[model samples]
Target: MLEFDIWELYRMMLRSRLFENAVMKLWEEGKITGEMHLGTGEEAIVAGVVSQLIDGDAIAVTHRGTPQFIMRGIDPVLLLLEFFGHPKGLCKGQGGHMHLFSKEHLIAASGIVGSSGPAATGFALALSYKKQNNIAVAFFGEGAINQGMMLESMNLASVWNLPVLFVCCDNNWAVTTTTNKSIGGTLIDRAKGFGIEGCSVNGTDVEAVWELANEALSKIRNNGGPQFIHATCTHLEGHLLGDLLLRHNRDPVLMAETADSLKQYAGESLNEVLMLLRKIGGQTKKKGDPIVFIKKKLKDDADRLKLIEEEVTKQIDQVVNNALEISKGGMKND
Candidate 1:
């Protein structure tokens, strides 16, 4: 028997892959509008980071946050429904592509480029001010480092010595703009400028990321200042929703040789990756064969829908009522 819960990890990775593939299909069929940033080869990063989080800890995510949010216990059906613009979405269909929020868990994500950093820092500051042990993790892309708000947030986070973990998913290219041309200096150097400890790790290695993140998080929980981790990963697909363009401008062989993480991880030929992709694609197709599955889900009983709606409403009402009661009466019943 194998050691460690490899089965669970494999299952989660499979689920993430299936979810992204389904979303791509929706995008192809003209269902999902707006830009779709697929986190194809970056599943390891989300899994590693989320494994360290407690139930109530907050997370601020960027546009490429679907995998992270899904890994954080968000239902796959609800996520799919959200992508399809259904009322049963996490955000009630208001947030598409990049906006996902769960108030109960204090988990919020944004679509804006490089915006989550500041929001995460603010959440951490609030936690510090309240003297709570809760920590906040901000997930952003390498492109975000160029944003002034991200830099400012780092400065504030360091100055306040907040319990915030800044994770940089440096996928090398920011929507086709090479990081070399766009990001000046190193990611660790930027963190050093803010007087925060920083490290650059291999993003594709889940074990490495998990170990490092755990140590960093432990330090932060002990009143250590904010930490920065630059995960240098690769993007197996194009920058966005569409198929690869600019074929003439780029060499396929060279590109394949350079940025494919699957090949790097497998330490094998590209053929191995192609075979694995084929296997995954075949299994996914089989799982989605029964159209009745989706049809039945879509045609859920009206009474059941109403009951669910009522339950959700009652929950919201109870929360609001409790808040009002706590505000009116102090901490003690006497």
Candidate 2:
């Protein structure tokens, strides 16, 4: 497995959570005018999967991909500006949250369905042609898996012996519908038909996803071919943020308990933030929030971790304020 610093993993996950929380606040305040989707409970999958990828690697992410962008080392200030439709965003405010691209980082995300799969195949083909010891990863939800192009791309990757990793972030729901109702057979099993190795894991468990992804990356790099990681994760909110009507399997009680757990994390005058988290958490039914889950894992050093979170929260707040000021002032990044 890829050896990684556990604390760094925790730090990145915490940062992703704080950033999402910031976006939620901005969206509620009518600053990020559009559909908002926060991957609060699903942060681990992105953290785990992306941590295993390095500089030369290429990645294509789906609509619920801001966390993936954060894990890829994109600056949150720029991303915030982009989310706010400011010219300073990663795509200069044109792409918003769904499309974050950085050629230097070899990363791209699309708001469209099943698009990343083919995009990844093309990247893998390039990497192979250049004889580079790099892999391309495509991340999509279970709903996208049903798309014909998605499966076709997997086949293309396998037939070409391309170094590609397909990560199906299966939260079991396609918007308001469950995956079992929409999909047939198993994701891992179906990959065998395409002559690619596949496995499923607990998406909330970041370490597990990292370990599996590391193994797949190693095999792809050393042996040359495609592989799959089917991650079964949880979504704490609707497919779209503030979409109560599309509520699928959320549990108000669990969310309330999650809210209670945040009291100690709240600082003076940050009660609004705490209240926001609590309100969102009350609607969630996931077994554990990614940030809270990792905090529990680091319980032995909870004091230090908590301090780190406080520091991160401060940084996020500062960056967000700066981004908003720049956006509101009509300052151009160009």
Candidate 3:
């Protein structure tokens, strides 16, 4: 059995959450621009898998990759600076949040759907050439599984017996559309079609995901070929920071305003919008928060947990302030 420190896992999740929360605040304050896609609900999954990664193990993440990058040990200051559009960011502020790349950490992210598959597959191929026993991880949403490139990557990994773990953070929504509405069948079944064996778990349960990921990584390290993990989670902030469908559902005034506009122009799509809102509302109600779930388990050690939270919050606050300070003067290109 794989033993893990639940407190540490909780800390990782908490740190990622707090960092993103700070980013969200920056975006809300107009300090950051563009649509911000956060990995708020997939914290457990990212922390669980990343905790087991060793040096040389590469990771390719989907659009909501802040948590993954942070867990993989990327500097939060540079990441924040990147979001702040600083020249000394991970990609010199060119990649933004979605297109972050940390070559030193072997981590890459993209906003395009299904891109992680190819990216990770390429990483796995490189590792295979080195025969380093290192592995590559592809973190993406369930919706990406339907893409042809993703399926091809799975097939190639299985065929080559590459050390890659395809982690599907299934939040049941592809943008505003639910999984069932868009996806044809189960995500596991799709992986199976590529001859990749896998399992599913609750993403909100940090310990559960950690245990499962540990087993999967062990198998890959043992030359058991590629594996897949389908973890169901919730996107607490919807697809984007200020997502209209989710906002409309939560705010009556916004709903009224959206409904009126839709009724005036796109009356036929109004019911469809409301139906999606209902689904989103239902998803939020049913899903559990990863942070809350783990915190409940550690409530007996409230003092320690409180200390960790405070420390992490302080660290993130310092990172933000430092990044902001640097952005004021700007860092020259190397």
Best by lDDT: 3
Candidate 2 has what TM-score?
0.87
| TM-score of each prediction | 0.72, 0.87, 0.95
Q: Please list the C-alpha lDDT of all candidates, in the order they appear.
A: 0.70, 0.82, 0.89
Tens-place lDDT per residue, model 2, 1-334, is 1476677888888888888888988898998888877777778888887888877899998888888888888888889988988777888889988888999889898888899999999998998899888899998999988898999999999999999999998877676566757888988888998999999988888878778887888899886599999988777766788775333125556555655786677676357544444444444654656666777788999689879889988988898888877787775665
Stretches of model 3 off by over 4 angstroms after superposition: 1-3, 261-268, 331-334
Q: How well is each residue in 71-127 modelled by candidate 1, as lDDT tens digits?
A: 787765556656655565567667875888887778788878888899899899888
Tens digits of per-residue lDDT for model 3, 209-233 = 9999999999999999999999999
Candidate 2's C-alpha lDDT? 0.82
Pairs in steric clash, model 1:
none
lDDT of 3 at 232: 91
After TM-score superposition, the amount by which residue 305's alpha carbon in candidate 3 deviates from its true location, in angstroms, is 1.3
Q: What local lDDT does model 3 show for residue 288?
A: 62
Q: Cα deviation of 305 in candidate 1 (Å)? A: 37
